[model samples]
Structures are given as structure tokens and as C-alpha cells.
Target chain A: MTDMLPTGATIGILGGGQLGRMLSVAASRLGFKTHIFEPGANPPAGQVADRVTTAGYDDIAALEAFADSVDVITYEFENIPTTALDALEAHKPIRPGREALRVSQDRLTEKDFLSGLGLKVAPYANVESPDDMASAVAQIGAPSILKTRRFGYDGKGQARLKSGADADAALVDMQGAPAVLEGFVTFTHEVSVIAARGIGGDVACFDPGQNVHKDGILDTTTVPANLTASQRMDAVLLAANILNALDYVGVMGVELFVTQQGLIVNEIAPRVHNSGHWTQQGCTIDQFEQHIRAVAGWPLGDGSRYADVVMENLIGDDMDRVPEITREGNASLHLYGKADTKPGRKMGHVNRITPRQN
Target chain B: MTDMLPTGATIGILGGGQLGRMLSVAASRLGFKTHIFEPGANPPAGQVADRVTTAGYDDIAALEAFADSVDVITYEFENIPTTALDALEAHKPIRPGREALRVSQDRLTEKDFLSGLGLKVAPYANVESPDDMASAVAQIGAPSILKTRRFGYDGKGQARLKSGADADAALVDMQGAPAVLEGFVTFTHEVSVIAARGIGGDVACFDPGQNVHKDGILDTTTVPANLTASQRMDAVLLAANILNALDYVGVMGVELFVTQQGLIVNEIAPRVHNSGHWTQQGCTIDQFEQHIRAVAGWPLGDGSRYADVVMENLIGDDMDRVPEITREGNASLHLYGKADTKPGRKMGHVNRITPRQN
Candidate 1:
């Protein structure tokens, strides 16, 4: 049942954003055609995809047709509607499986699963009602965060709690959605492990990259993140354990907080993450190709880092600096081909190769 | 008039083979869309391009429409029909210009142009008639080659002359077409420089790569070709002189023969050469991207190579070994997404990274 997809097979991707765009290019590299299902017209991925279905996920007929045309189904984003997945999964296999999506869709479930596996996570509790919120505050205390359990990204759908008295205001930020209250874990910095699990249960992890965020968005990711040998080993091992627990079958991004006591798991994304973009220049085989290989059931590639690289996202107004960036030596520019430049929009990224420190 | 193409502009490619396919991917990396014009249905480039026109080159109306749809025109192969170029050039800028095409279209003109620039070339004479063939034989002697002046590649339209008595047989191979009789020269090995010229007249050349051909098709290209520093500088300078003389804007492949005398110019290709494919693994900027940058009027990327690489072409039954190749570590596989693999057809190529020797 784990037969690999043959060359010339069409892989259906659910979202047609920049991640999907890079994945489409990587799929073409391996002699596979890609069919993109994007709701927006002229999606960034559609320009490179072999075919695109410009229909909403609610259009079950379109989803079924998209599934029927491809050998397997994979996604760029994890917030896919349940009905769309149900329809598509009926026709073809969706890699990373429903179990991964089920475990990662809710913050409460993901935290519980990681903790159950003997991994350290930020202290948290459910905030469903007024009494529950008070009990959560009493248990976890103030200086925490109230985050909706699902569909939150890039600092959206989140509110910070200054003290126990601020619980009501923070709950208001949830806007009636199920929420999780997380106590702040003191950490020096953040790092992420880009890991992949093949169909035959083989796991591989790229070296951790240190991430720095600005205004709740990823600004830059630097490889060879300052870490002791033991910390790096622990990061890879915990990421592997999570993938094994979920029986995952594609690349997963495990964000970890580096602390004096130990590394704490912050979050796990089912699809490729922004922090892994550096692999495009640092490794022979990048994260997008790694995910495609796992989903296609092919043998994994060598993910070893050969150079020091810094990947910086070009968001919004950064497009104006393209002409200057194009002249910078050793900088690899990758533009998203988006039509408009809206503030806070991820325009593209540039990977700058730097000399390795011995 | 020398202005850079803004992001979101379309680049129209004239041929839709593997080279065009890779070019389209590179163009997309720089935020430009690609439209491929090819007579064949479902060309390999079309699978990744934003648009594809499936009309013959003789269709002037289609050519005009394609030109109108793009900001500039470039190509993968050099054998484009003149009438098509006439129509497309009327609507948009055709990069590399007509002078380049005129000089490279015929073997006689190419040889004359190179020798005119004081570059070393094989001794040759025109053979348009029986009397001319006799004089060419007398002047060049036996153990030579008689090749048609136009549309010859991969050892086609060529015949060997073992002796003066075999001149008639070699002429017969040309089928009464205009031909050239060339005297052979002894060389140690063959090397090629993949060089590019920007709109601003800036020239950059990748390191020479040693080439080995099998059955007249390029089999392998190894970087860091064995050459003294003086020989390397001579190769690059000679290539730059040719581009400068022609005012060429795009990447060109300059094939050279290494002999006891010096490097001899074997031939020049107006498009990216197979020998330059190793740059995909060895350098920060590859030949395809360098070509795109030149055509788009942008500054050329850093052409400096940082790693040792060997590129091997996969022809015919080589597709059968893809599974084994995929499992090999450090081997970067680039399949052309070709649907059929016929004998002698280029299905794809693989670039293997090796340790750099001091």
C-alpha cells in the first residue's frame, strides 16, 4: 500500500500560496506535475502549477474532481475545511494523514499530545467559560496569553494577559471561539527543527535554525543557531518523537523555545514552515523537496547543511528594495509574484549565504 | 533605453525543451512569469510556464500575439525560423539580437566570425560545387570532415573524409547542400566556458568545465577543468571579446579545444550549454538564471563557483535507474518531466557534488 508515485504523476495541492508555489517547483524538479486548488484568482502557485482549480473548498464537486485527477493529495496549509478533506480523501490518499491534522488543528490537543509523550510544553489550561477562565488564571497565574484553540497564525486571534484582572479583556479577544490560556515560559530564544518522516518510518531532521520575529511575524532565520551539542540533539529527538507519535508522513515544523532548564516545544505545524526556507540555499535538498519526497513515498534526500545561511522574509514594502537586493552579491532572491503589495503581506524571501564560522 | 524589467512581467521563450523548462523555473524565481511558444502540444516547458502557445513558428499572427504578451523575447534553441523572428521582433525586443543569430546560424559564418576576431579556429574552406570540393580537398588534405553549413547538431549532416579519394562520398552525404571541409587538429581534451553579458555590457564567465561526449552527445561535464591560470584567463577573455564584438546580451556557451598550441574555439552556442549545467550545483547563480538576468536587463548574479560538481546527462534507458539514483545521498536529480524516453533522447541530468580538492 506504500507504493511510490511514478514519474509524471500529478500531485494535488490544496492551497496556492507561496509555500505551494515552492512545492510546485520542487515537484517539477522530480518529474512530477502539480495541480493546484486555489480559491483566489491568479494565485502565486498557479503561475508555475500545471493546472489550477479556482474554486472554494466548499465546492465539493470541484474538490472531488481535483482529487480524481491526481495520484495523491497534499496540502500547503493545515487549516483545510473538514468537509473538503473528507471529499478529497475518499478519492486519493492525503499525505501527513488525517491524524496529523487532527492533532495539530487545536492548540489544546497538540499540547496535551506532546506532554503525554514526556515532552515539556508551556503551562496551559482550557478557557471555555467564565468559571473556567477564573480557574485557569488561578492555576496558571497572570503574565500569560489567551489564544484561540484553532485557526490562529502570525499573532492573529491572540491576546496577552497582563494580570489576573485582565482575563475578561483577553477572553473578549477570542471572540467566542474555544481558547487556551498559556502561562509564559521564560526562554532565552526560539529555534525550529524542520523534520520529515518517510512512509517507511524513516525520519530525518535539518539542523535547527534560530528565528527572530518582529511584530509577531518571522523576520529572519539563521542556520547554525547558537546551541550546545546536547540542545541540538534534544531538539531533533523530540521532533522525531512527535512525528512518530502522529504516524506522520511529510515534513513537519517543530518550533522549540530554548531555555536554561531544557528545550520546550512551542508548536508543531503539519506543513512546511517559514523558518525552513534557509534550506533552499544551505542544503542540496531543500524542505519543499523533502516534503514532496515523503508525500510521494520516495526515499528521503540528504538534508545536511553545507553552508551558513540567513533567510530573511521580504514582507510588504520590502518589494521596493528588490532592485538594490538584485545587485547584492551572494543573495538569492525569490519573489512570490503577487500582484499587490499589502502591508503585513509576505512578498517573498532572500537567502544570503555567509562564510561558516569555524 | 536600458531599463530593468519590473516584477510580474512576462518572459516569452521561443523553444520548449528542457532548457526552456529550467529557464521558466528560473524566471519564476525572480518574480517574472514565462510564456512558452512551441509547435508541439504539451511541451515540457509548458508544464511549468504561465502560458503556452501551440502554433507553428510560421504562424505570424500567433508570433505577433506571443510577442505582444511578453516584455522581451528569449529562446532555448538557436534554430528558430527567420520569419517568426521577423514578426516577433516587430512587437517586442528579441534579446541576443539579430547579429548573434546571423553569425551562429551557419557553420561557415560562425567560423569566419570567430577567426575575424583573431581567435584560433580549425582551417576550413567552402564546398558549394564539385570544383570547390576538389580545391577544398587539395587545400585541407585527407582525414577531414565535410559538414553542412546549416541545421547540423549531434553529429548529424556530417561525414568523415578518410582520404582525398573519399571527397565525393563525403559530398554525397551533404546531399548537394552547401558544406564546409575542415582539417582536424589534435587536442588533449575539450573544455567550454559558460559566459554571460548583461544589458549594461558587463561580462561574467563561469569556470571552464571539461566535457566528455558519447555518440556526439554530451555525456558528462566536470568542473575545475585542468588548465593553467594563464590558459583559463585566455579562455574567458576570448569569450568576452566575442560577446563584446556582437554586443550580445544573454548567456553563451563557448566550446574550446585544448591543444599544445593553446585553446582553440570549437564552436559557440547562443543559448545555455549542456556543459554549464554543473553550475546548478557548483555556483550561487546557474546558467539558466544568468541567462534570464541578462535578458531581463538585471544585474548578473555572482557566477563564482564554491563547490566541485560533476554533471551527467541521462539519456534513453537511463530513466530506469532513477530509483537507484534517488536513494543515493548528495546526488541532485533533475528530471525533465518528459513523458516518453526514447533512445538518445535527453530525459534528464543529475549533478553530483564532490569534495573540493585544495
Candidate 2:
């Protein structure tokens, strides 16, 4: 068994966005200081982290220095460049490991991996060229979505196809980048299972939360998601299967589509997910803290929900209501220290908690 | 009403210890940055704060720079040098105000203020010399405790007087500092109410938590304390009275001794108290976050308890049990990033939570 990190160990975080900021706070709660490495100056995580290295991922010297300064490394985002990981892995251990990232970094690979584990996912076909797009359309049919294979997030880098006649436009939207045509599933609603795997391969999963997205961005996630007991069990089991298969040792957010047939895998985030923010108010230990514990080689905490919570994201102009939100008796607000409030950008979130029904 | 601080405003905190560390995290959660000022090198708060000013309180230049950089100022420890506060207050507003500090900084003043407000407090007499000690003993009688008037905490600068025979020795223990003779109250148990006052004079108090002390240090604080509904209401009312008395605009920890007759105010802390740490898992917003909200002139969050929590302190060697503690399914451990753990030094705490019964 791997030795657990003692208090006062420094954790190297690869990104400095809101996820990294929250992760840094959680790391500090566990007596771990974080050193955030981000290309952007004055990133959110840097505001609370012990230190920050402002350099691009391709800067091998910076990566080596960051890796050498910390005991263990973890990342807030999975789109980290392969060359950067190659440099970092040589010097330090990265929890969740490289395989988890390699699988989730690409759309096609994530779908293939989930399907290989006997989990149902949207039918998808790789589209490398215009001809491939026609073939994909023929196979996957119309009313599918064409998404880039890599480096897409928050509804970015995706194009919708209404019919076969729209295939050429969707193909053009891909800008000749490698893409995947995913046939849309007629699902009732979306839910996500936030699970963690300890270094010793122990898996723990929080209750799945029903998610609602607006304009391709997550708007709210409510606990006690409309899931039957059997569906809940399947959600957790599938998430655990993915974690164990990858030998993952960190928190993973598995977005699932609750359909008439069964739970279909939508996607997976290898770090703390937005849908899991409700856990901060609803569970004993939140997803960020659980991730910190898992990466630090501590035992995974019980992720059972103790309260019903609805977590709503404060996006851009939604931040204008903060003063009023602050006055709400049941609302717990969490704001990221970002200066700019661009449209669709997440500024903060609030979790409204209520007593759990037995 | 004071205008609320904008999201990006900086909060200046004095005494960069564990309290400041937790407060800094809370400030970050509200989109505010913290600048911690401490005389010691590598203070715990510095690990999670946006800026750290390592300079003595007497350093006027450093104080000026810090005050100029922050919108509001607050202190973690009440023993801050008067000259320092005078310097900082000239530049920025200090929430919970200087009056709250002046009253709580000295035990005698605190006792006097509570009694003047028609709150029950243990009989106390000021002691400046051996003659005064003898007079105090004559008045307050035996089984009294001699505590220094200033710069004392965690049972320090205190001597127990069993009878008249021990008066001289107890006076000697004072080391010539001004003291207070507090007649020991026969209390069934101790409870503390964590309360907050917003800039708008809105007050909110968390349910009192029963505290257990070991060797004059807080060991555990359990919510749903052994109190009748009447006692609970009295605790909250008295706490609110104290806050209004000082026109306080921040969190206060009011420690009370439950006597057969009524609740006696033992003392009050101007900042978030250790006994209230249970709220981190029991409430929608923890005491630290409430303190930040009050100081920032934002609306106070609901302080009602939603869970039954027992918070246990990890002091000194108790940190060794952290590995075992982390493994406990219901435990949520919070470790201070203190490099050295001397005997009696608080290392961290854990809050074990369960659902609240209706």
C-alpha cells in the first residue's frame, strides 16, 4: 500500500480555474498547501494557493520545477496536453493516473471505454473527414451531434445536425478537425454520479444528482434525482466499474442519461464536477474534500447525502442577484474570485438545502 | 446602513493563525481576497491567503500598507496591540468594532459589561495588588480563579485559589499584572452560542453547542446540547443583546455556564470560536463564512443547525490519530497547517455529523 501524505505536504495543481480554486481550498482544509500552475496570470486558484507558477504547459522547465516542489500532483482539468503530462509524470505521481485522463480527454475514446465496460452510451462514429462525416451520418442517422474529439468543454466545439441535409454544415463547423457523430438519445433527464476511488481501490459514490443544462451549460443539480432504487444502484455500480477499471484514485463525475431503457453514459469528468457542487451542502464530505483525501492516500469518506439540495449556478448576469441571494435563509453561496463576468461564464453557485426524507 | 463590500475587495486580517486560515478560505468562497498580517514567518493563514505581510504590529509602514490595501480590517486574536489598532482604524473600518474588542480583551471588562447588561455572570473583582487580592478573596470568597486582565488565553496566566491560604501564591502567579478574581460558578455544563450581526443590525445565532474541556482547553463541542427550548432561546437572546450592545457587525462566540438559576455569561470572543466549529457540518453556512459576511456588510446567512454534530479538537499528539480518524466513515477532519505541534497546541479538529431529528 502507498504511504499516505502527511500534513503540510504540498499539492501541485495543474489548472487555476474555479475547480482548481475550490480544490485548493479543500487541500488546505486537509493541511496540504497547493501550488497552482496556470498559463494565465492571476488565475482564481492563485488567490488562495500557497504558490503559483505562471507558465504554459509546454514549458518543460516550469513543469519540472512545479513537480519537484510538490510531493504529489493532481489536476483540475483533463484537457492537459500529453507532452506536459509526460514531463510531469517523470518527476511525481499524478493521482487518477494517466489512463483515466487519456480515456476521457477524447470523445471517441471515452465512449469506447464506457461501452467496453458494458455500459450503454450514445451511439457514436468517428468522423475524420467530410467523407467520414457522410458515412457517420449514414450510420448514426440525423438529429445527431458532431463534437470535436478533444479539447471541448462547457458546450464548446460542438455542432448539431437536424437532418442529413445539415451534415455538410456540421462538417464545416468541425473545421476539418477529428470529430465524433453521436446520435441523440431520447432521455427523460440527465443525472451525474460523483464517485471517488482511494489509492487502495476502495470506491465510494454519492447519490446521483439530477442535472439541468441551459444553453449547453449546467444550470442546476438537484439531489434525490428522479431515479428508482435500481437506477441509482446501476449508476453507482457503473461509476465504480469505470474507476476500478482505470485504477483511478480521485473523484470522477460521471454524467448519465436516464432513459426509458436504462442509464446511458453521457460523459465523465476526471475531477470535481459542477454537478457535484451540491455535495458541499448536502453531504458529510464534499467532492473537493473527497478528491483531496483520495489523492492524499487517505481513506475515502462516506459520500452519502444527508440533506436534499438544489445547486444553482450563478452564470454571468445571474451574479447581479447575489445581494438578494445572500439574503435567502436557506441558500449557501460559493463565489469564485473572478473579476470579469462574461455571459455564460460561471461566477458562483448557491446550494439550497432541506431536510432529507427518510 | 454601511454599503456592502464589492466582491473583489480585500479583507485585512491580523494574527495569521488557524482562525485566520479558516477565515481566509471563507473570504475566498465569497469572492473576496484576504491579506494576512503576522509577525511570525510562514503563518498558517499565509498558505491560503492572497498576500502575507510579515511584520510586527509596531511596524507603522507595514500597517499603513496593509490598511491601504484592504477595504475592511479584522483580527483573529484580541491581544492585538492598541497602537496597531489605532493605526489601522485610522485607515479602514474594523468590524465587530473596537468597542467589542475593548470589552472582551480584558476579563474584568467583559464581566462588567455582561453584568451591566442585566446578564448573569460569575461574581468578579479586579485585582491589582496583593491587598486587592485579599479584599477580593474576602468579598468573592474561596474557590475563585485569579486571571490576568489582559493578554491571556487557553487557561494561561491563570491561577486557582482554593481558599484564603492560597491567596498570596495566586497573586504571585499573576506576575504583577492586573488580575480579576472570578468566583467559580457551580455549573452543570457549559454551552456556547455562535452569533452574527450584519451591518444592517440583523442578528442570527446558531443553536448552542455543549462544550467539553480537557485541561482548560476545548476538547469537544456537541450540538443539540442538553438545553430546554427556553434555555436555547435565552442563550440566543442574550447573545443578540450583547451584539446590539456593542453595535457589533461580525460573528461572536459567547460562552455560557448553565447554572441552576440561569445561563451565566462566562466570556465572549470577538471572532469565530472553536466551540462553533461544529456548524461547519451542521449549518448551511459555517461560522467562518458568517463572520466574513458580517464583516463585508453582506446579509447574514441562516445559522440554524440542520445536523447534529460533535466537533472534537486535535491537540498536540492527538494529530497522530488523524490517520485513524480519517478512516472513520462519519468523520470530517480539518487539520491546521502548523509545522510544529507542541503539547497543548491545537493542531486541528473533526466534526462528526448526523441528521437532525425533527
Candidate 3:
């Protein structure tokens, strides 16, 4: 790839939340300035970024100016407006590419794409209308999840169908948006591999982190996840396959379900994942820096875990524990400079670290 | 201590250099915003900091405005002007306080302070005139070094006397500036103890790092320094003693010489030192973050080293090796966002890490 971006290049980032804030810090560490394109006023990313353009993604003039100013464009979150990408792509390269975003933006497409690769994914069917929902319920059966195919995150835009009797209510919950009915996988645990693909096609994956969710949001992620040696290898190989298939460049968070049959693809986020936050304390190169390196066309860093870490998200009221957490010497606190602490908001995270066992 | 300054409190940093840049990044990590006060345009720290005020320290009105804007004041460099501190002291508390600056700003005062603390500093004498220089040489002997008492850094404003020859020329080199003559310690290796003092008088010290100087400029700092366990303890104890004596409220880098007699104090930096940069990759809590925590009146982090790290400085032309360094998976690159690369300028550093031995 064209002699890794020389020092002093500007990285244009979409979405100016905590992820963008951390990414901007990582970019600055690598001698790159960041220009945050955040529609919101006084974004957290703006506090650390070199520049911030406070304009909506639909503002073509602002988008063009941002694209023109940066050497490369990347996003902290998926579901970027298509028009924004169109405007940005004409000006600079967007790492992770449009294909990754296109496939992962919708639940149905992501499942179909994973299934197409001969990867095991939860049994799923697309649902558009009431008849389609009935048909999906018949095929996927009860105890399935009905979710909007796009722009859904956390527990939002989703409903659980305990039985075929709840199909009508589940479908209504999708609010007429194109939806997917996914049969729940009988899994032992949920784990995520934070992997990166360089411009040269080299791939590296951090050790999978065993995750727990509270209120459908990631609560904690612990490294040295309970896995056989073979399972660990399978996780890395599968993540690499997905990155390669999409011709991806930059970091990706691949969620997987460990079932008795095999590993099932849960989902993929085309950016740094909350589950990977432990890497900041456990590894030499963090996920944010790894993403920046890939987007900058530099060689991928070793994702080897040097320490065992447990990362707990400080969501909303969880921030009240800051005083106590701050006094915990082993805990490395990372607070997102968000002013408000409304319920369910990710205010920060703390990574408690310990030496790894041989 | 003052409830830890609360999140989002602004930290006013004097001297917008690489140290300030890293400190600002650390402050941001802790949810604290940083305002950089710099006389130069587009300083490296300003690129990452939330705010930048471009004005000389002597500007009383600007200083007052900056002091009013920040909740607390701290500095990156020791040679802060007296007038600036006088203007700021009324509006905000400066951590590490005036005593650190008062002693460290002059080579003579620093030596006297260290010696008064029962620390073994090099044999030294103050030089204000030719008579003093002549007396110093008569008492301390030949092959000693003469350095200006103030404003000397990175081998600048220094002269060496060999066999008492060129004494007149060495004195002339001072240009009437107050100077100090020091007898060299017959040491085996140079090491630095990076120590921090919290607001509650709690002290934590990282293991000493073996440092190598290239032409009086630090080139590399490797952890697990060549020292006996007893010597290591002494280093930490002496460092803590210095902090306690000053009633220090921030990180200090204590340079020492391992001599046949014992460890001798070389000097101490009142702020984060370049030698401690390796902690960014080697420890869970790095020196920069430690400094931030101390200055912010938060509990000091555990200064535990989890990995053995060799940090190599990327000085000016050394940046040409960045591409090669980037390819090294074990290397964690930290580049200061410097636009220009002049000879003798520190552009960046790379921390090469390996798991520590049991």
C-alpha cells in the first residue's frame, strides 16, 4: 500500500461519540490529526480531535470539506448515511470499504452473507409484511427474535417472540420496517474477537473476550475467555475469513456464539467494539490504534494479549462508582468526556488488569 | 481531596510540548479537559488539547484569563516564569507547587535540595564568577563538567574541563550566566525512578529504567535495569524521600547513578520525564496518567510494571526508520504530532514490549 501515510496526515472520522473520542486519541498518538464530522454540538471527540465539523451527514458541502481535508475517512459507527459515503468516497478512501458496511448494516444481509461463506449463523428469515412474518415464524419457529434490519443497536428495535402466538406483536414492534426473524442459537457463551485487516490483506485478531450483557448492552468483557485451544484458533480463522471476504481494511468486532455443534456468527461491527476495550490494558497495541494503523495503510500490530483483563462499562448510573473505581490501583479508568449521564448512556469504562498465566 | 476535581474540570498546562501533548491525552482519558498555554503557534500539545491560548507567559492579562478558565494549573517544563505563576496563583492551585519549580529551575538549588535531604548527590559548587570557577576546579579537581544554573537542556549551555585545561574558555561559554561545577560520579549505569505523590501523601514508584544517552540526549530507556534488589529499593526510597520533602503532589523523575558506594542522585525532573515513556506500554498506569492523577488530586495509580519494555527515541532523522519500526509487530509507536523534523528534535518514541519474567 502506497508508503504508509506520512506523519501529519489528517483522519476524518464519522460519529463523534466515545468511540470517536478514543479513536481520535489513538490517531494523535500516531502523529495523525483527526477531524470529527459530528452532527451533534460539542461532541466528546471534539475535545481531543484537531478539528470538528458540526454538521449533519446530509450537509454535502461540510462533508466535502471534511473529505477534502483528511487523507482517509473512517467511521466509529456503522449505519452511516449512504449519501455521506457517496460524498466522502469521491474525495478520499474509506477504510473497511463500502462492502463491509453494506453487508453489516442490515441484519438479514449480514446473516445471509455469513451463511453464504459456509459459516454457521443462527437460522434466520427476512420479514417484510404480516404474511412474511407468519412465514418466517413457521420457518424460524418460536423463541426467536424479531428485529429491524437496519439502524438498530443495543436492545433497541428488537422484540422477543416466545412463541408463534406472539408473532403479530413482534412484527408490530418492528414498526413496518424491514425485519428479520432469527432462531436463537443454543450457545454456551457469547464471545467477540476484535480483529484488524491491513491494506496489504494481513489480518490479526485479539484473543476472544467472553462477554455478558445487562439490559441487552455489554456489561463486562473478560479476557482469557473459557475456550479450548482449537476454539481460539477457529475464532481467529473465522474472523479473518470474514474480513477477507469483504476485502476489509481496518478493525472489526466479530461476535460469535459457541454452540455444541460449532461456532455460530452472531454479528459484526465495522469499528472498535466495546467488548474489545480490555485490549487497551491487556495488549501492546489497542483496538483503536490498530484500526488507525490499518486505515493509515500501516502494518498491523501484534494483537497478542500480555495481561488478563476484565473490562466493565460505566453506563449512566454506573459512573457513580468512579470515586471507588479511581481508588482501585489495578483499574485503568477511561472516561468519555460526556457531560450528561442519562440512563443507559456509556459514560466510560474501566479495565482491571492482572498478569496472564502461562 | 476536594472530591477528585470532578469530571470535566479544565487543567491548564503550561508549555505545549510533547510532554504536554501526552499529558493532555491522559487528562482526556480521565474525563478532564486540558487548556494548553503556549507562546508558539500550532504547538504539538494544542493539536490534542481542548483549548490552546497562544500568548507569552509574561502576558499578565492572558495569564489571568487562563487561570480563571482552568480549575487547576500545572506545567510541563520547570522553567516557568515567576510572573506567570504569580499571576496564576491567585486564581488556581498549581500542583507540584512553586517549590518544585523554585528548586529545579536552577541546577545549584536542585543539588542543594537533594543534598539536604541526605541524598548522595555529586560533589558540586556554584559558579557565578571566574573566582568561583577557579575555586570550584581547585576543590573538585579536573575533568569535571560546568553547566549553566538555568535554561539548559539537551546538552545545551554545558562545557567540560579536561585536566583543568580550557577553564577560561569553559567559563566564557557560560557568558556570565550563573553556572555549577560538578564532579562526575564513577557509575556503572544510569537509571531513573519515576515516582508520583498523591494529594493525600501516598507515594508510588515504578521500577527504575536503565537509560542510555546519545550525545547527552536520552536515546533509550529499558526496564528491568541492571541493579541489585537492594539498590532498586534504595532508588525508590530516596525518590519518595525527595517527594515527601517537597510535599510534592505530582510525578517526578529521579535520575540516579549506580556507584561503587551506592546510588547517587544525578538530578530530578519535577514533571514527567522522557525516560518514563516506556511505562505507556509496560505498565497498566503510565507516567503521564500518573502525573495527571497526582495533579488532579486523584488517587495515584499502581506503578506496577507488567512487561519489560525498551523505548527508543525517534530523534529527527530517526523518524526515517518509522516504516521499519511500524512493521515490527512488537513495537508500539507513539509519535508526537510534530510538523517539522529538525536535527536534535525528538519527533517520537517506540516502545518494544515483552512479557515480564516470573
lDDT of each: 0.93, 0.93, 0.93
Query: Model 1 over residues B277-353: C-alpha lDDT tens digits?
Result: 99988877899999999999999997988788989999999998999998988889898999998999999999998
TM-score of chain A of each: 0.98, 0.99, 0.99
User: Residue by residue across A39-99, what tens digits does model 3's lDDT show?
Assistant: 9999999999999999998999999999999999999999998998999999999987999
Q: Per-residue lDDT tens digits of candidate 3, residues B78-167?
A: 999898898999899998899999999999999999888888998999999999988999989878899999999999999998868878
Show where candidate 1 strays beyond 4 Å. Answer: none
Q: Could you tell me which residue pairs clash in candidate 2?
A: none
Query: Which whole-number lDDT from 0 to 100 does residue B206 have in model 1?
Result: 96
Model 2 per-residue lDDT tens digits across residues B1-358: 2388989899999989999999999999999999999999999999999999999999999999999999999888888888999999999998879999999988888988999999999999999987898799999998889999998889999999888889999999988999999899999999999999999999999999999999999999998999999999999999999999999999999999999999999999999999989988888889999999999999888888888899999999998888889888778889989999999999999999776873
Minimal lDDT window, size 10, model 3 chain B: B1-10
What residue pairs are clashing in model 1?
none
Docking class of 1: medium
Provide TM-scores for the models: 0.99, 0.98, 0.99
